[model samples]
Target: MSNSKLYKGSLTTIILKLLNEHDKMYGYEITQKVKELTKGELKITEGALYPALHKLEAEGLLDVEVAKVDNRLRKYYKLTETGTKETVNKLEELAEYIKTMQALVNPKLA
Candidate 1:
């Protein structure tokens, strides 16, 4: 998320997709999950993550549920009705983007 443009625009889509698969997720959990999935190649920094989450929440694409867990209130996020549909659209768009990049980078592979 630092300087790679590919990872920049896809942060929200990634969050949405993860929420689409899971019931809900807290901030650190999301970051750790991304790291585990990517095998440490990609990292979601706090500086980038919170603002994006706030933006999505502001946009009505996400719902928050706060609960006390082990003496700490964890704010979990999940997709809204609109976010569910938006996740599908964003996934399709990302898939198309990957396809296009493949075609451009390696004509034979695409």
Candidate 2:
């Protein structure tokens, strides 16, 4: 599958799940983690990633902290209590989506 298409639907869940796993992470760290975990199958673009992060923050699904790291200020994101609940919902929804797709693609086996 094309990189864009593969990552299109899963970006938010990936981000949420990563935060769930790590407690907090910055933008670059999130991107790098996704790349490493996926073995380069996914490449997140700044244009796509930052906007989503901002949106989630606005929606109160994320809490952001700005701190000085070395020579620059970095923003780290963590799931709020609401965000943790939402992450569970999102993951369940994603799991259902995958199962549905699998059933469609392999009806006989299913």
Candidate 3:
């Protein structure tokens, strides 16, 4: 599902889930990690990513840390306490969504 609209709604949840697993990550790193995890099936663009990050930060769901790396400053994002709690909620919601989708997509199997 490369650049599929279906995944767009879950982007924030995906970001939260990744941060929950990794502790912290920079923007580019997040993009690359997603691609790696999905085996190139998904590619998250800068346009989609930054806005989501900014929104999450504004909502107090994330903390930002800046460190100089090889003469360049890199901003890393990590979940705040609220964010950690939110990750659980988001994941549960995703699971419910997946179940609903599965039931709809394959009635017999569900």
- CA lDDT of each prediction against the hidden true structure: 0.94, 0.91, 0.96
lDDT by residue (tens digit), candidate 1, 1-110 = 35657699999999999999998999999999999998888898889999999999999999999999999899999999999999999999999999999999999998
Q: How many steric clashes between backbone atoms does each model show?
A: 0, 0, 0
Q: lDDT at 76 for candidate 3?
A: 97
Identify the runs in model 2 with alpha carbons over 4 angstroms from their true place: 1-3
TM-score of 3: 0.97
**TM-score of every model?**
0.95, 0.94, 0.97
Comparison by lDDT, 1 against 3, better one: 3
Q: In candidate 1, which residue pairs clash?
A: none
Report the candidate with higher TM-score, 1 versus 2.
1
Comparing 2 with 3 on lDDT, the higher-scoring candidate is 3
**Alpha-carbon RMSD of each model:** 1.3, 1.3, 0.9
Candidate 2 lDDT tens digits, 1-110: 27498668888898899999999899999989988988987888878899999989999999999999899999999999999999999999999988898899999866
The number of the candidate with the highest lDDT is 3
Ranking of predictions according to TM-score: 3, 1, 2
